[model samples]
Target: MSNPNSLVEGWARRYGRLEARPSNVNPLDEFSGLSRRLRGLRLKEWIGFTLLHPDWYSSLIIQDAHYLASSEIYAYDRAAAALHQHAVTMRSGSMPMPSALFGHRYTAHRGDYSIEYEFDDTDGRHVLAIDIAETATAPAISGELHLDAAHAGRPLSVSSRLPGRRSRMYTHKAIFPAGGVLRVGDREIVYRPERDLAILDEHRSLLPYRTTWLWGTFAMRAEGGVVGANFVDRPEITGEAEESCVWTPTACEPLDDVVFEPAEPADPDAPWRMHSADGRLEVEFTPEGRKEVKRQLGLFAIDYFQMFGTYRGVVRGAEGSYEVQGVHGVCESMRARL
Candidate 1:
């Protein structure tokens, strides 16, 4: 078999810009046609969320992995400079795919810990309800969050084929108005709809044995309107299907190649600088706190970093320019071999 990375690079060199499918298309139907080039090759899926508020940045990650299933909940309090995290993993675990892309429920459970990400539509607007339960650990953390799609723009959806094989990857990202209350031990943090927002990430990819990627996303309120973006720097795997874009209240604008520069690459909480080749995106990130994970199970290993930060810069697009001022967000870098 050919190396998936090499095939993706060559494909990108030959065909510059990859086209994305319409958001209404079903990803599972697209996956059904692929011929598994190698047995035991993994098809991974996950539902990730980030809710940003003035005083707290909270996130929930649920992975429907084949090698190892896991769920993680994390929050950073800016005022007290405190971090709370809870996670659980099970080897050789798996989850069923959602019945449909738009209105479906996805879940992950292990022992006394469980997570659910349910999606539905209410009067033409998208609604997502997230619930987490962790009854096994001390100071156990749990919560329910409600998010509604408030932007008028279409979501950024990419369903691209890999080179030299039938493998593929599908990604969907969007920003929404969020509100909720999280119970952390004896304390509670509330997210107000007026000031808080959430970013939703849904991914399904049939990947090779080794892969790595750098990704950053943030959403903020600007004078123009609500602004959000998703940036990824991993051409070897994704090629021109970068899924990088600047989202506005009116539309989603595809972005050219982007670059991520960290003041201290080794530091999980280091400040970051990001820019696009087209000179449309220029931003600086100052992190308030971060969560790091290092895990190894048999032949699988991963090193992940998720940082909570505030963004200060400008995002120029076809509609207009958005001035980002102290907007709470998140950025992540990860490498894994499974």
Candidate 2:
């Protein structure tokens, strides 16, 4: 019933202090633009971001892409590292986010990413959504999955799917390194390289099923510090990268012109592959190196589907002519009622 971490609540109270202030920023103006921008592009370029906590019993849903830019930690890292994530372009044009989606995009630089949803009721694209990403680290479990001395966070948590579930809360804190704090909370974790600050958790809600969810962001630093970036939370399990994106330094914005294509899986236990438009990148995430952080609450069997390392392959922005490597991190899993 209550988010154990109380992150959303904390965010509401401290959002102003931690992130930049525009005073009159509107969610609809920021998020809904995704559709109009891509109105001319092929339908294949539309994408959405979402977070799903699935288990056998109760599940929590968080859907956001460009609702608000309240956290500077994200806004800064995302805008700073635009090359790695949204390799194509964050938006198609400038239409604004759909009023239905409950999310926002935050970055120190507004030109790096974009947001948009398909306007199915009247045509060109039948989707509506947004995506947020930065050069930050996601929650992790040390090098190994077991309770190691360096392990942090809630020690890996899991839950299941229960439609219409109430919002669960948790303190958005991480055992961050020196100066790695994003939006000040009880703790901080490094999501960026070196400091590796964890891309701490935030508040989440739900979108209609059959609707996609692509959540989380990632990027890499290259020559002159030009970062290619993208964020996705495709929770539908259908395996689509339309909402998943990656972009370069110039022309980056939210819900504008973002798109991703999942690469074919080579191994049964490896991270899946994905590519941004124009084949600038060939990125894949491997979960084989992760240790399972499991927890069971009610009919839900939740596990932090984590791999100690990550699998990455890029050519230009983040990838370099068919290059490949393993990345270390954890993947989350939750199962709830059918």
Clashes of each: 0, 147
Error of 2 at 296 (Å): 4.6
lDDT of each: 0.68, 0.28
User: Residue 263 of model 2: what lDDT?
Assistant: 44
lDDT of 2 by residue, 1-338 (tens): 22232212322311211111122222122123665243212111112221111110011112222321211111112212211112221332332323222233222224433233222222111221223343354221111001111322221112212123221111121121112122211222232333232222332222222233333344333343223334444342222112223333332222212333334434436445555446665566654332232444354233433222253766454333334454332333333221
Clashes of 2: 147
TM-score of each: 0.83, 0.33
Residue-level lDDT tens digits of model 1 in 177-223: 77777777776878776667788887767655566777888888655
Error of 1 at 58 (Å): 1.2
Question: In candidate 1, which residue ranges exceed 4 Å CA deviation?
Answer: 1-40, 91-94, 122-138, 150-153, 162-167, 237-239, 266-268
Global CA lDDT of candidate 1, please? 0.68
| Model 2 alpha-carbon drift over 4 Å, by segment | 1-201, 207-217, 226-228, 231-243, 250-271, 276-280, 291-296, 299-304, 315-334
